[model samples]
Target: MVDHVYDPPERCVAGSVGPPGQRTFFVQATDGARRTTVSLEKEQVRLLGTSLVQLIDEVAPREGSEEAAAAYLDNAPLDAPFDDDFRVQRLSIAWQPERERVVIEAYDRPDIEDLMGLDPEGDYPWDGLPPQSLAIVLDAPRARAFASRCTASLEGGRPGCPFCGQPLDPSGHICPRANGYRR
Candidate 1:
C-alpha cells in the first residue's frame, strides 16, 4: 500500500462537510500543490485531536505552547476541491523526540464490506497486505494548532443533549438520561 507522507506539510487541518448534525469529517494535508484528504468518523477526529494535545503536553510541556498554538492557529476552512482520497479505518500518533515532531498516521479501508471477514485478531485477510495510509509530521507549534483547530471544528457541530451528552438532532433526541423523552 502507498504511504503518502507529508513531512511538515504546508497546511494540515481537520474539517467537516455538511451541516452540524449531518457533517462528514475529514483530515487534509497539503504539501506545495499536492493535497490529500481522508474521511473519518467524528469520534476519530475528536480522539486524535485530544490525544495530540495530551501527547504534546506530556513530551514538551510549556506555557508558550498555548500562545504559539494561538499564534499559528488555522481557522480557515479545509482547502477546496474537497474530495476524499480514502476512508480512514485506524489512526496512530507518536511524538518523535529526536525531531521534536508529531507524527499522525491514518490507515484507509475503502469500504466496510472489504472487512466482512476478519480474523480474531482483527487482522485483514487480504494477501498480508497493509492498508493505504497518510502520514503527516508537524512541529510543536503546528501540532498544537492542529489540535486546537480540531477542537474548534468539533464544537461547531450540533449541540449535545444537556441530559445525556449525545448530539441533539434538529428534531431533538430521545435522551436516555431523560427517560426516553425527546429533548
Candidate 2:
C-alpha cells in the first residue's frame, strides 16, 4: 500500500487597489480539487499591487506539510510596494491536511483608524464595510502564533479585530469565526 499526498487548488490570488477610493479585487483559484475565496479591503488590494494569481503562487502552502506552509506564510512579508501605507495588522493561517485546505487571513491596516476601527465601539461606523478581512484556504501547518497574537491584540486590552479597525466582542461575533474562530 502506498500513501499519496494531495495538493489543493490555490484560491484567492493577490493584488492591490488603484489609488485611494478604488475597489480592489482578486480571484479565488480553483483547480477542480478545492475552492477558496480570498477577501481583502480596498486599501489592502491596492497595497498588494500585484495579480492575485501571482500572489498565490508566491504564498501558497506546501502540499502534505503544515510546518512548511506555516513558515511560508509567516515569512511571506507584505509586498514592499505598498509597505509604506499598509501593514499587516492581523493574520490568521489555518491548514487542514485531511481536507487539503489552507486558510490564510490578513487584515489590512492602512493606519491607526484602520486599526482602531476593528473595535465595534471605537467611534467608527461599520454599517457598509465589506468585512475588510482576507481568508486564504490551502493545506499546510497551522500558523498558530499569528492567530494567537491577532486574537490577543483584539481581545486583550481593546475590543476589535486589530487589523481592520473593526469592533469585536470578547464573547465572539454573530459570525462565529470572530476571535479568529477561537473557542
Candidate 3:
C-alpha cells in the first residue's frame, strides 16, 4: 500500500538504453531533485502511453486543456544504479480534476504471501518494499507528448516484419506470419 507519489513530475517518459533486439524497457519519472526509474514490459509502456493520450482527450474537464499541456519534461539518460522500486508489474491511469493532470500509477506484482493466501514465514508484511508503487502526475499536453514519445521509442526499435508486424532484429527475423520462413 506504500506509494511514491510525484505530483506534477518534472518529467515522465518511457525509454530504453539498450539496442533494439536486446533492449530493456523502462518508465522513468523525475522531479528535478529526485528521480525514479523502473523496469516494465514493453507492452506495458506502449499501452500506458497510448492510454494516457486517449484518457486525457476523452475526459479532461477543461476545453483545449490537451493543447495547453506543457511537454517540458525532457528525457535525460536514466540515472545509474537503478533501485528496487524501478520494476513495474502493473500500471493504472486516471484523470485528477483537482490537479488538472493525469495520474499514472505503476505497481509491483502481488507478493508471494498475497498470491499463496498464507504467509508461512509469519513475519512478512504485505506492504513490503518490492510490492510498492510509484505514481506520477502529468497534464494533458504532457501526457500526449509522453504517449508520442513512448510510441516513437517503440518504433525506434527493430524494424517490424512486414509479414506479421513483429519486430525484426538487425540480423534477421523468423516470421511466423510467413509460415516460419525467415523474412
Candidate 4:
C-alpha cells in the first residue's frame, strides 16, 4: 500500500546515484515540508519518462492556456537520501485532467517463493514485512522536464551496436544478427 502521497510535488525528478549503467536510478518527490526518494529499475525509468513525454504531447497546451500546471523542477540534488524502504518494484502512472497533473506511484516489489510452480504461502512462515509505496503528482511542465532528464540520462551510457542495437560493453559486443560474430 502507498503510505506517502504527494498530491502536488514541489520537485519531482528522476536521477541517479553513480555513473551511467552502473548507478542506481531514483525518483525523488518533494512537497516543501517533506521529501522522499524511491529506487527504480533502469528500464522502468526509461519507459516512465518516455510515457510521460507522450502524455504531455498528446495534451499540448497553448502558450498562455490555463490547462498547464506549471510545476517545474530544477532537477537539483534530492532532498532526502535513498533508503531501502523506498525500493520500487512496480510503477503506475495516470493523468488527472481536472487538476492537469500526472500522478505516479512506485510500489515495493513483493517477495514470493514457488516450489515447482506451487505456492509457498502456507508452507513458509511470514516475514512480517509489507510492501511500501510512494505516489507523486506532477504538473505538465514538471513532467515534461522530468521525462527529458530521464531520457538524456539513459542515453548517456555506453553506445549501442548498430547491427543488433544492443549495448556494447568496453570489450565489444558479439551481435547475434551476424551469427555470433563480434561487431
| Best TM-score among the predictions, by candidate number | 1
Tens digit per residue, CA lDDT, model 1, 1-183:
447999989999998999987889989999998999999899998999899999989887773288877877888899987788878887889988898889898886535565667564775544366668899998888898999888877877788887789988899998898788889
Question: lDDT tens digits, residues 1-183, model 3?
Answer: 546788778777777767778778777777877877788878888898778767877876354254454435455665665553557766788887787778788877644445585655666434464467898877777777777767766766788777789888776788887788887
Best of the candidates, lDDT: 1
Error of 2 at 121 (Å): 5.3
Candidate 2 residue lDDT tens string, 133-160? 4444543333322222222222223355
What lDDT would each prediction earn against the true structure? 0.84, 0.38, 0.72, 0.72
Q: Which candidate order results from sorting by lDDT in descending order?
A: 1, 3, 4, 2
Q: Which residue runs does candidate 2 get wrong by more than 4 Å? A: 1-11, 17-89, 106-121, 127-134, 140-183
Cα RMSD for candidate 4? 4.3
The TM-scores of all predictions, comma-separated, are: 0.85, 0.27, 0.78, 0.77
| Candidate 4 lDDT trough over 10 residues, lowest sum | 62-71
Worst 10 residues of 3 by lDDT: 63-72
Candidate 1 has its poorest 10 consecutive residues by lDDT at 118-127
- In Å, residue 62's CA in model 1 sits off its true spot by 2.9
**Per-residue lDDT tens digits of candidate 4, residues 69-104?**
334535476555566356776777888888878888
Q: What C-alpha lDDT does candidate 3 achieve relative to the native structure?
A: 0.72
Task: List ranges where model 1 is wrong by over 4 Å.
Answer: 110-130
Which pairs of residues have clashing backbones in candidate 4?
A: none
Clashes of each: 0, 25, 2, 0
